[model samples]
Target: MESPDHPLAAQCLQTLPKIELHRHLEGSLRISTLRQIARQHNLPFPSNADLPALVQIQAGEPLTFANFLSKFQPLRQFYQSPQIITRVVEEVIADAAADQVRHLELRFTPAALARAQGFPLNEVMDWVIESARRAASQRGLSLALIASFNRHEPLELARQVTALSADRAGSGIDGLDLAGNEAEFSALPFAGLLREAKQSGLRLTIHAGEWGGAANVREAIQDLNADRIGHGVRVLEDSSATALARERQITFEVCVTSNVQSGVCPSVLAHPIRGMLAAGLNATFNTDDPSISNIDLTHEYRLAVQELQLTLAQLKDRVLAAARASFLPPAKRQTLCDSLEIELAQQIST
Candidate 1:
């Protein structure tokens, strides 16, 4: 149905250097890779299941956040060992590099993996950090880790994970994030943990207002002092909150298809990304769960440019914004910025 020369499709696939600020590590694994890993582990996978149908579940009419979250648990079997985690990290980096993503901020909940594998939380953190270093070296892409806490988990446990994540400032695990179903629990419950995390010099990025409301986004910034928001698409509903986002230059990580698949937004056209940009809010596109959504950063960029009709120049700026919001060091940030400019110029000249 679509061809390379198709005007809109061509514009969407422009090979611009990209930066992914809000990618879930577990969610980014390639579905084929997921199957391979399951095979390697001798884990049960349905033989006659609808592969394409299951992979593109998000592309269906619409799905609730609960329905979307259900897909993640089926792949939990592969996340048991540090070796597997390390391998997944390497594969994730390779996928990003293949997508031409120059920078990535990956989020994961260490507690879940630790509990699954009978490993301590700190040990899991150590393995992820080490594995990330190896992956970065191979791809030459900057990567940062954001340790997450399941919202439904005990508040004290979340606080502990936050403390542990912040304890290793210059080493790895750059920040703390509160993730999982936003509507299932209150962000207020973790306010104390977030405050302590900020005090320890670690940055904060929270998953708010995706399935929740603008109030959740408001509280994440006001209460948790979140540096950036993960999928705060609902912020447009509250004029005051949206204005504050613009005033503070708070970044909102927009995952287009993911929102539709997760029922956070109704349709691709109904997405509020353009509205947020029009309101002067800082927003950038990302693939929240590349594996689950069956897409990648380049695909998302294409969707924004083609289906969403964002100009190439605007997409260029969005890539730059993603790099700026990422947790990379200043020197690395400049390198990414320079790479983006070079790629943009090349695309134009071609």
Candidate 2:
């Protein structure tokens, strides 16, 4: 089980100046805001007292993928308008800023957003992009939007999202990610589009090996050419798979809490991030879905130290590693690395 949150300790750990690379915009929606939207749209959701259980993983729930995936179903109903879409993006960013998350790469599926209201794909992308551009600026946060495609969706939908991402690369979109239903779907269907995304100058990240196995991790690296692997804790299941990732030096955006909640890991204590590090693999801590798991980056940092037995020094190393692995271009990436180095130097074993 995870430990109780220490608010003050979290304040100090905030000096990682926190860089988060794997958070999902959809999964990051505010529960209270969801309630407001529910009332406004007359969406048939549970009353306020019971809403969290519907959209969030409750204690003692079966920690299985199907149970975890079901949480998003109620959420899908709330994106009923463009104002609602933009409001969610802005609030998610604002929440990140409040957490002292200085650098965040928020990945969102346009198809999911568009599907809810029958909004056009490009319109959904623009709503997110424009809102993110404005929100990050107002908050003085370094935020990037990753237009993610669900692997289970039609390959044509993926292509349309990729093309839109490529067209708006520099403006607000900085990366593309393949997310969703990794258990049943293969990344192969969207491989060519991902490769084309890379050529179009959009960085690639693929969700693999969390619900599936380590072979998916290998596939993400070799086939999809992922710049980073999302929740690749299962990569240790296969030695050759582990070796391939180590050789490529692929960054694994390891989400400690989400893995436990989703049953990817048996529990937080059993997360393989430390083992991944020992094997010379590059790993970074991230909140896969802060709202869904009822956790923030601070909660994850606390776990990294107290439960995972990571020294604050090692925690700092992971933050820098995430910064180095960010999809930002050479100049901005170096600047982020430089700034994090200065801030992380302020913390010590506590």
> TM-scores of all models?
0.92, 0.96
Clashes of each: 0, 0
lDDT, candidate 2, 147-177, per-residue tens: 8988888888888999999999887799999
Candidate 2 TM-score, C-alpha based = 0.96
Deviating ranges (above 4 Å) for candidate 2: 1-11, 14-16
On a 0 to 1 TM-score scale, where does candidate 1 land against the true structure? 0.92
**What's the true lDDT of residue 170 in model 1?**
66
lDDT of 1 at 205: 89
Residues 1-350, candidate 1: write the lDDT tens digits: 23433775465464567888888886776667666766787766765344434444644434877677777776666686788888888889898888887888888878766775678888898888999888887898888888988787888789778878878876897778888768878888888888888787778888988988999999888878899999999998999899888888999988998998888888898999999999999999999888888888888887887778777777778887887787777787787778777877666432
Deviation from native of the Cα of residue 4 in model 1, angstroms? 11
Best-performing candidate as measured by lDDT: 2
True-structure RMSD, every candidate: 2.9, 2.6
